[model samples]
Target: MQELHDAPLAPLTTFRLGGPATRLVTATTDAEVVEAVRAADESGTPLLVIGGGSNLVIGDRGFEGTALRIATTGFHLDGTRLELAAGENWSDAVARSVEAGLAGIECLAGIPGSAGATPIQNVGAYGQEVCDTITEVVAYDRTTGETVTLTAAECAFRYRNSTFKDQPDRYVVLRVRFALEDAGGLSAPIKYPETARALGVEAGDRVPAARARETVLRLRAGKGMVLDPADHDTWSAGSFFHNPILSDEAYAAFLARVRDRLGAGTAPPAYPAGEGRTKTSAAWLIDKAGFTKGYGTGPARISTKHTLALTNRGQATTEDLLALAREVVAGVHAAFGVTLVNEPVTVGVSI
Candidate 1:
């Protein structure tokens, strides 16, 4: 374990907009992670678990507790079953699965963060969610003070949320196990229309796993979703807002509002989320609300390449980013009745 006092946290996150942590502990093994957590709990200190730092937004005030960075590494593959330590890089793990001819997670390529963090957010991209392949999550149950293994069903996986997320302080994920498909080196059936169009194949068609992974990476890069230090647009927490899933009544009202704002012929992106629920694109809402690409004059602005991402243009404070986000949210709500919700987890701040 490596420990530092009053460590700057901005450099750890993709947005690069936070103050310092009172104490930072980098744990390279599951044992160390558990030990660190126990120590913090015993001392009654608040604990913050950090992984790849892709989906985090720490405030300028920073965390007054111990920020534990999970850096453990382990990737064990037994036939089609895979087990990864909490600290394994997510995007790299996807590539490795593709190289090994696994078919389940190819569509999640280029997503940032650690493998352990995937279950917390039920991370998904291009129609594939971690819950689709994840069989179990091994975590330290802080409440019980024992390590426990929870099955997929027990995780209560939902759209971009899970049991771990709902009860953030209850469990410390140590490892994740997945059951991937061995589809003869072919990718899983393409589900997202955008990905299918990019691959020049019809939806439901199966291509080479590597080809699917590469195609998704290319698409992500084009939208500034992939990490590129040279590109300021990539300095963002992927999508700034979650696609709002509204009830039938809410959707009807939203549609009426959309027609009122953008003419009766205008149709915003809508997809069936579940029974009587519909999911609409947050990107479309933001764009239609007049916050187009590169939508701010301050250090924080929407990505020039994508409407969904809010980027930090080289120099930005947490307040600057939040201000831009609030503006986008209020603008979208004024244009349409639907309110936008942030996708990234905020630390010591509310948006």
Candidate 2:
């Protein structure tokens, strides 16, 4: 375990924004992690658990409590079962799985975060979400002062949310176990249309696992979803907003509003989310609402390569980013009658 006082947090996140924490603890093992958490809890100090820092947005005021950075290292693979420490780099783990000829997580390549955080938000991209392959999450329950393993079903995963996210302070994820497929070294059937098109295969066709992983990484790089320090466009938390899933009645009202704003013939992109629910693209909404790519004059702006990402252009504050996000949300709501919600977790701030 390593401790620092008043540590700056911007350098830890992909966004490169945010202030400092009163105290920062970096734990390199599960035991250290638990001990750190227990200490904070026992002392009645507010605790903020951070892994990868990709999906986090800390305010300029910074955290006044203990910010525990999970940096533990553990990667145990037996046959098709894989267990990773909470702090393992997510993209690197995906690459390792692909190298091992695993077929489950190839599509999740280039997602920025730790393996532990994947379950927290049920992290998904390119038609793949972690909830599909994740078998269990071992977490230290702060409230009960005990470590528990919860099955995937018990996690209560929904679109970009889970039990851990719903009760953020209850559990500190320590390890994640996944069940991957061998598939004779071939990838899982391609589900996302864009990925399939890029690979020149029909949806449901399987390619080499490594090829699938590389292709997704390529696609992500093109859209600035992949982290690249040299590129301002990549200085983002992947997608700034979640695709809004609306009820049937809400979808009907939104479609009416879309037509009202974009002429009677205008049609919005909609996909079936679940029974009587439709998921519409937040990127499409932002673009149609007149906030194009690179849509801001301030330090914080939408990525030039992707409309979904809100980035920090070298120098930006959390307030600047939030301002841009709020503008985009209001503009989209005004134009389409649907409000966009942020994907990243915010601290000491609301949008």
Candidate 3:
């Protein structure tokens, strides 16, 4: 275990805009992780867990408590069953799965984060979500002070949210387990129309896992979802806003609003989110609301490659980033009557 006091946290996040923690503990093993958490809990100190820091927005004021960084490493594959420790880099794991001829996670390639954080958000992309393949999650239950395994269903996944996210402080994910498919070296059937179009295949057609992974990585890179420290566009928490899933009634009203604002011929991107729910595109909303790509004139701005991503173009403070976020949210809501919710978790701040 490595420990530091008054540690700067900006470098830990993709946004690169946070302040510092009162103390920072980097745990290299599950035992170290548990020990750090237990000590903090017993001492009645507030605790913040840091995984990949891909989907976080810390306040400028800094955290007044302990920040434990899970750095444990383990990646074991037994046939199609895979287990990843809390610290294993997610994108690398996806690449390994594709190299191993696995199909389930191919579409999720290029998503940046730790494997343990995957279950927390039920991370999804290009039509494949972690929930689709996750069989179970092993976490250290902070409430009971014991490690426990929770089945996928018990995780209560619902589009970018899960029990871990709902009860953020109650569980420290130790490992994530997934059951992938061999698929004879072919990828799972293509589900996203954009991906299918890009691959020149019809939806439901399968391509080589490597090809699928590569294509998704390319697509993500185009949208600034892939991490690249040199690119200001990539300096973001991937997509900053979650696609709003509205009830049928709300969708109808929103559709009317779109038509009224953009003319009768105009339409917003929509998809069935579940029974009586419709998921609309956050990118579309932001664009139609007149916040084009590369929007903003400050250290923090909309990504040049993607409007859905609010970025730090270097020298940005958390407040600057949040200021841009609030502007986008308010502008989109005013234009479309749909409020945009941030996809990343915020600490000591609300948007």
Candidate 4:
């Protein structure tokens, strides 16, 4: 275990914008992690658990508590079953699955963050979500102070949310287990239309596992979802807003508002979220609401490559980023009667 006092946190996040923590502890093993957490708890200190720092927005004022960074590494594969430590880099793990000829997780290839964070957010991309393959999650329950394993259903996985997210302080993820498919070294049937078109295959067609991973990586790079330090557009938490899923009545009102703002001929992209629910594109909403790609002129702005991403262009404060985010949310709500919600977890800040 490594410990630092008054540690700067900006470098830990993809956006590179937060302030500092009163104390930061980097744990290389599950034991160290639990010990550190217990110590903080015994002292009655606020605790913040960070994995990849991909989905976080810390305030300029910093955290006045213990920030425990899980840095342990473990990757064990038994046939089609895979277990990863909380600290394993998620994107790299996806690539490894492809190399091992596993079918699941191939579509989640370029997402940045740690494996532990995936279950917390039920991370999904290209029509594949972690919840689809996750069999169990082993976590240290702070409430009971014991290591407990929760099955997928018990996690209560929903669109980009789970029990871990609902009770953020109650559990610290230690490891994640997934059951992937062999599929004769072929990828799972392509579900996302964009990936199908990019691969020159129809939806539901199976391609080489490696090819599918590479195709998703290419698509992600184009949208600045893949990290590239030289590019300001990639300096963002992949997608800033969650695609709003509205009830039947809400969707009807939103559609009416869309027609009023855009025109009778215009239609906002919509997809079935669940029974009586419709999921509309956040990117489309931002663009139609008059916030085009690369929307802001400030240090914080919309990513030039993707409308869904809010970025920090070299020099930006947490406040600057939040300001742009608030602007987009307010404008979209005013124009289309749909309020956008941020996907990243915020500390000492609200938008």
Candidate 5:
């Protein structure tokens, strides 16, 4: 375990906008992770867990407690079953699975963050979610003070959320186990239309796993979703807002508002989320609301390549980012009745 006092956390996150942490602890093993958490809990100090820091938004005021960075390394692959330590890089894991001819997570390529973090938000992109292949999550239950394994069903995975995310302070993820498909080096049936079009295949067609992964990476790079240090556009917690899911009545009203404002022919991207619920694209809403790509004049602005992302243009503070996010959210809500919710987990701040 490596410990530091008053450590700067801006460099740890993709946004590079946060202030320092009162104390920072980097744990390189599962045991160290547990130990660090236990010590903080025992001392009654507020505990902040960090992984790849890709989906985090820490305020300029900083955290008043210990910020524990999970850095453990373990990638165990046996046959089609894979177990990864909490700290394993997520995008690299997807690439490795593709290299090994696994079929499940190819479409999730280019997503940043740690493997442990995937289960928390039920992280999904293109068409694949971790919940689709995740068999179990091994976590230290802070409430019980014991390590326990939770099955996939027990994780209660939902769109962009899970049990761990709902009960953020109750568990510390240690390892994640996945059951990948051995599809003769072919990818899973493509589900996202954009991905399918890019691959020159129908929606249900399967391409080579490597090809699927590479194509997704290319698509992400084009949208500035892939990490690029020199490019300020990639300095964002990919997709700042979750696509709003609306009830039948809410969807009806939203559609009416859309047609009223943009024109009767204008149609916002809508997909069936569940029974009587519909999910609409956040990007479409922001763009139609007049917050187009590269929307801000300040240091914090929307990505030039993607309307969904709100980025730090090399010289932004957490407050600057939040201010821009609030403006976008308010603008979207005023234009349409739907409210936009942030996707990233905010520390010591509210959007």
Candidate 6:
């Protein structure tokens, strides 16, 4: 275990923003992780569990207590079953699985974060979510001070949310277990229309695993979803907002608002989210609301390559980013009666 006091946290995240933590501990083993969490809880100190920091937004005020950075390393693959330590870099692991001819996670190849954090948000991309392959999550339960295994069903995963996210302070993920498929080196059936079109394959067609992974990575790069430190557009938390899922009544009201504003010929993109729920494109709403790509005059702005990503163009504070986010949210709500919600987890701040 490595420990530091008053540690700067900006370098830890993909956005490269945030202040510092009063205490920062990098735990290289699951035992150390538990020990650190227990000590903080026993001392009645607030705790922040950090993974790759890719999906986190820490405030300028900094964390007042312990910030535990999980760095434990383990990757076990028994046939189609895979177990990963919380600290394993997510994108790299996806690449490895592709190399091993796995079919389940090829589309998630470019998402930046730790394997542990993947379950936290049920991280999904290119129409494939971690929830689809995750069989079990082994976490250190802070409430009971014990390690417990929760099945995928118990995780209660939804679009970009899970039990771990709902009770952020209650559990520190230690390991994640997944069940991948071996389709004789073939990828899973393509589900996203864009990906299928890019590959020149019809939806539900299977391509080579490597081709699927590379194609997804290329698509992600185009949208600034893949991490590229030199590019300001890539200095974001992938998509800034989740696609808004509204109830039937809410969707009807929103459609009325949209038609009233954009004219009878105009229509907003909508997909069935579940029974009686509709998911609408937040990117479309933001654009229609007049916040175009690369929108904003400040250091923080929408990514030039993607309308949905809010980015830090080298010199931006958390407040600056949040201001741009709030502006986009308010603009969309005023124009279409749909409120956008942020995808990244925020600390010491609310939007």
Candidate 6 local lDDT, residue 317: 98
lDDT for predicted candidate 2 compared with the true structure: 0.93
Model 1, 1-351: lDDT tens digits are: 999999999989999889899999999999999999999999999999999999999999999999999999999999999999999999999999999989999999999989999999999999899999999999999999999999999999999999998999999999999999999999999999999999999999999999999999999999999999999999999998999999999999999999988899988899999999999999999999999999899999999999999999998999999999999999999899889999999999988
- Model 5, 1-351: lDDT tens digits are 999999999899999978899999999999999999999999999999999999999999889999999999888999999999999999999999899999999999999999999999999999999999999999999999999999999999999999999999999999999999999999999999999999999999999999999999999999999999999999999999999999999999999999999899988999999999999999999999999999899999999999999999988999999999999999999999989999999999999
Model 5 segments more than 4 A misplaced: none
Per-residue error at 210 for model 3, in Å?
Answer: 0.2
What candidate 6 gets wrong by more than 4 Å, as runs, is none
* Clash pairs detected, candidate 2: none
- For model 6, the local distance difference test gives 0.93
Task: Estimate, for each residue in 1-351, the C-alpha lDDT of model 3 and write its tens digit.
Answer: 899999999889888878899999999999999999999999999999999999999999889999999988998999999999999999999999889888899999988889999999999999899999999999999999999999999999989999998999899999999999999999999999999999999999999999999999999999988999899899899989999999999999999999999999987898988899999999999999999999988999998889899999999999999999999999999998999999999999998
Candidate 2 lDDT by residue in tens digits, 1-351: 899999999888889888999999999998999999999999999998889999989899889999999998888999999999999999999999988988899999999889999999999888888998999999999989999999999999999999998999999999999999999889999999999999999999999999999999999999998888899998999898999999999999998998888899887888999999999999999999999999899999999999999999998999999999999999998888888999999988999
- Candidate 2: how many backbone clashes? 0
TM-score of each: 0.99, 0.99, 0.99, 0.99, 0.99, 0.99
Score residue 24 of candidate 4 by CA lDDT.
98
- Every candidate's lDDT: 0.95, 0.93, 0.93, 0.95, 0.95, 0.93
Runs of candidate 4 with Cα error greater than 4 angstroms are none
Task: Estimate, for each residue in 46-95, the C-alpha lDDT of model 6 and write its tens digit.
Answer: 99999998888999888999999999888889999999999998989999
CA-RMSD of model 3: 0.7
**In candidate 1, which residue ranges exceed 4 Å CA deviation?**
none
